[model samples]
Target: MTNAIQKLYPSTKMSIVLAVILFTLMMPGYISQYSVFPIFIIIAFISGVGTKFLSAFIKSIFVLVLFIFVFQCFLIPSDTVIWSKGILTLYKEGLEASLLMTSKIIAISSSLIWFFLVTPIKDMMFALEKAGFSKKFTFVIYSTIQLIPQMKKLSQTILEAQKSRGIETEGSLMIRLKAFLPMLGPLVLSSIQQTEEKVLALEARAFSATVRKSSYYQMSKKPVDYLVISVIFIGFMIFVWWRFFK
Candidate 1:
């Protein structure tokens, strides 16, 4: 059974995420942008996917944000030097820019990550189809979203198979690198084979037939969805006024 938040319409969840992205873009200062990150964590916990959400965030976006911060601090040129040690120098301007950029990245990425974590991909595609999206468009969206998780799963399976075969996958960095290199060949070939199989399966199912498709699953927006969307809109407008007019 899904929780209340997870049970909400995909469109509703998408709108909430879009609002977060918009706010991150429009809001000034590091504090506001960084504030959105924790809000996503709170939402993830409320939705009962906090552990998965944090694991994914740490493995992906956290590393990317950290890299951007480090690169900007060291590489970007500026007259105002904040810190220096030996050949390394940190610029005040670069640090400020990095904070702003990384904060936006975190807010935007976390919102999206939270949405996908809470909402299943199949349900999202179904909702898009209900919202008048073409099947082809929805299929592309579904495929793109599923690609990463699918690849990750496949890689893990292959790694385990290698380990079972007495391959040295868990050792020094060089040993792991060697193990990983062999896995790449199999991974790529397996991915291609899976794609062909999927294509054949789609054809067998008349996926491209010029006929209408019907689904048994029905989804509709509830009153609470409207209430939540309204709250988000009101919050957005208030932020806009405060950001620009005030």
Candidate 2:
């Protein structure tokens, strides 16, 4: 996380921002098609205007969209509305497939951005507490979220180390997959070792104490939280009304 980001979100605020961003992004999937394009444009604007994490999320969106296009063009059931160009016919059924896939692609992209960048991991856990989660469960959830990025980087390091040691299985496609075994085993072992160390450290600190703990940056739902949440709820209702009842 950038220092700027850290300073901006003292933990709780980041989580609420992330949650709202995700909710707004998913609005397209839950409503009629009339709102889809407009929401898409808004999300695109968000991504485009962002200086950080924008390109990565955009690249992910493109990858998903391109895969969807391939699947729709080649795998969907054929129909009579095929565009016949000499020997090739592009089926109309593919259009529906493409739209569905596009929806999924955009939704997933938005979610990744909101959760990974817009929200800090600490803030996410804090928000979970506000949502009535038990402290123990929230601790575990927060730990896991923090662990993932570390784990990914560790896995990459392990893979590179194994590759450097001439652990080459590059000939056959199956052999290439089997090569992952070397990396996976070491990574899992490393994770276990790290977990054991963490457990001991937690135990030393009396982490399992029954006494309640107070938060320095306490997460209380302010008037803004309620006001923001209410606007979202009402917007959702109105969206549904316009979609189904209009």
Candidate 3:
């Protein structure tokens, strides 16, 4: 995202608008689960091209989808049996429910993560502002984008530290639950430490006191920006009409 994006999007606003359009298109009704495959292929290319941690990024998506599927298996209330071979008779409705939930979860997550990778946070926030979104809401979006990576790293660090400290995660479920508390302790502490560092850095840089700070890379809209915006707007209107009236 840092090094790869070089005016591929005419401006920050365009990239964000494109991202939102992709997000809407990936939904279940706007596009079916089967058709989402093509969108994901494009997403894979975009994320691969934009993000630096290609392996981890790709792996995270698989993990995310798998987790959603497994969670669905437990949470979905279905009566249809899955299998009738040997001693196994799985519920068909459960399987359908799991697949449906998994499709939605995976598509939504992939679309969002791909967008974050391909579009810079600054560009996204500015785009939201240009699109008439309130600054307060946009600020939340910006801060969340900035903090998620830090929180992910801190989570991994905590998990690894618990593993190294012999937390007995391989034991019974009860023991694992007990171990979770201690692991959460370190995660909390590290998160607090990171927040403090962010505060100090903000203060040192006079982050909010002075106004009219200049950006090093200004994003002036190009002809492509208008084209992309128009397409997205037209597409959105079509979708809304189809959803509400058709």
Candidate 4:
């Protein structure tokens, strides 16, 4: 039951993500800050992406989030000091600013991970195509998303080769810097070569020809998908009214 519900329509998933982002952006302070987590947890559990979403979110944004908090605490000067020690001081307003920024970042990041976890690349492309996006544009978008992992793998391969050659990376900063020089060369070259090959392959398949591309993939929305989408839409409206008109 859970697994089935998790497999929602790509459009439905996209709607929820956009709605959450919109709400987070419009509502300031604690409302936006606190609302995201509960919403994310609920979506994650229902969609069976709890572990994956959490792991990805933390790994990707943990450093940035920490930096924001620390930077704001020390750098942003305020009259009302929350904590003080000689030259160091933490301001109340600065801390509040840090918390708000961190919350927005986390909410946006988690929502993105949730979208990718639940929607396959092919399905996303198909959905975009159905929504009147050009096939070539969708292909480019998909390839760009895929490029990150490919580059990571390439970097790992380069590091392994360096390790085999006795280039110490886990030693002093200078040694690691030396190792990075060799790794950087091959990684960039290989990425460029891969891009060229992909371009050639696409050209060979008449990708640039003025012809309609036939898609084998199809996506359909169920009643649940509709219900979820409608709810998200209503939520967005209510948020706007409360934030502005009301």
Candidate 5:
């Protein structure tokens, strides 16, 4: 059976993540915001995408978060010094600011990353189309979302082709650099060539036809999906009231 989260409509998943992000942004104190990260990890595990989610998080956002933390701690102006050396010093206010900023960053990034990890792009596009988005608009959204993965796949194929031809892709750092340099030209040319071919294919298939298109894949928001979204919305409103009015 498919994972429960993977079965939910894309919009439902999106609403859940968006709620978490808004919560992280509005909630004061480092403990509250930072706590969202682990909660995301737990949700990822339950959703059966723990490994992929964590891998993407570590590869993409971990270093940036660390850099921001260190940078803010040392560079941001503050009156209270927490630690100091001749030329390097840490400020109390800076540390506090860094913690807050880093927590929000982690929370927001993890939410986005988790959402994408669990929701397929094809499903998202289908949902958008079903929601009355024009073909061209949905295609633009689809292409933008698929760009990075497509580029990575194309580059890997080119690298493999080079390797088959005895290119020295694996060696000392400089040798690998040399190998990568040769692939850049082919990669760019191939990408442009593919784009042209894709355009022609789309034209032949009447991609811009006025008739409504049908997709083989079908998705709908079930009762559980609506229930989850409602709960999230109510909780969000409650939090907003508690934060602002109460």
Candidate 6:
């Protein structure tokens, strides 16, 4: 099956993303924990991002979530003890607190991941530019987005070079830890050098010159874009009402 969500206009998708963020922020922790995740899980499954979501969750958010869970379980005291061993005690209250935080983080991160996974950077830049956003600000965001992959590739190259030089990256934990320092210096120096070069290039191109800019690509909003935007607005309003008036 095709991923229909990926086919939506960038503006429409961005509106939906903003709405999700607003909704997550407005709702209480308990409600967000109970509500936000299941909704996104379904959307992710339908959009064929379930595998990506799982991979992202594992690699990025999982560590933070685990840390919160462990921290709360140990430090927070409650009357209701779910588990206890010698010096360790797990409380129902701490579990609830951890779940609340985990859900909020997951909701926000998942929305952002969904946005980047489906929308091309050019399309995003085009949409923002059309919406009268600042070119300089957008350039920073766009540059950072492009820079991430370059840095990742650079790191991998540095690692391979070290391995080739008989730097034991594998073995005991201490050996790997010792290998890390050598990897760090080259990576940091190379990044700083590249950044300086980019700054010079941008200056040469008059990136800071105050003039209206034009995009080579054009983006036209479809009827579905309006419809999706309307739905998102209504959802935001409903959330506001429920959060404040209800």
Q: Which candidate would rank higher by TM-score, 1 or 5?
A: 5
Which candidate ranks first by lDDT, i.e. highest?
A: 5
lDDT of 4 by residue, 1-246 (tens): 247655678889888879878877878786656668767878787888888878887889889989998889888897899889998899888899988888888888888888888888887888888888898799889988988897888789888988999989898888888888898998888778887898999899899988777787666889999898888888788888989999
Candidate 6, residue 236: how far the Cα is off, in Å: 2.5
Look at candidate 5 and give me any clashing residue pairs. none
lDDT of 2: 0.62
Q: State the lDDT of candidate 1 residue by residue for 1-246, as single tens digits.
A: 369999998988999988988888877788988988898899899999999999999998988988988888998888999999998999998899999999998899999889988887778888878877888898888788769898889889888899899899778999988898778889998778888889989989999898766778877899999999999899889988988898
TM-score of decoy 1: 0.78
Q: Is candidate 1 or candidate 4 better by TM-score?
A: 4
Q: Model 4: clashing residue pairs?
A: none
Per-prediction TM-score: 0.78, 0.66, 0.55, 0.80, 0.84, 0.75
Candidate 4 stretches greater than 4 Å from native: 145-200
On TM-score, who's better, 3 or 6? Answer: 6
The TM-score that candidate 2 achieves is 0.66
What's the candidate order when arranged by decreasing TM-score? 5, 4, 1, 6, 2, 3
Better of 3 and 5 by lDDT: 5
RMSD of every candidate to native, in Å, equals 3.9, 5.2, 6.6, 3.2, 3.1, 3.8
lDDT of 1 at 68: 88
Residue 147 of model 2 has an lDDT of 83
Clashes of each: 0, 0, 9, 0, 0, 0
Query: In candidate 5, what are the lDDT values of residues 105-153, reduced to their tens digit?
Result: 8999889999988898888899899989888898888888779898888
Candidate 3 — which residues are off by over 4 angstroms? 1-31, 43-58, 63-78, 121-210
The local distance difference test score of each candidate is 0.88, 0.62, 0.61, 0.83, 0.89, 0.82
- Error of model 5, residue 222, in angstroms: 0.7
Cα-based lDDT at residue 162, candidate 4: 88
Residue-level lDDT of model 3, residues 1-246, one tens digit each, is: 444333345354344435454545545442375455456556556446534434544677667766665555545546765546664455666566667765665555555555555666676566566666765577677788778897888778888888898877777899989988898887788777887888888779866664544445456667766776777678766867776678
Higher-TM-score candidate of 2 and 6: 6
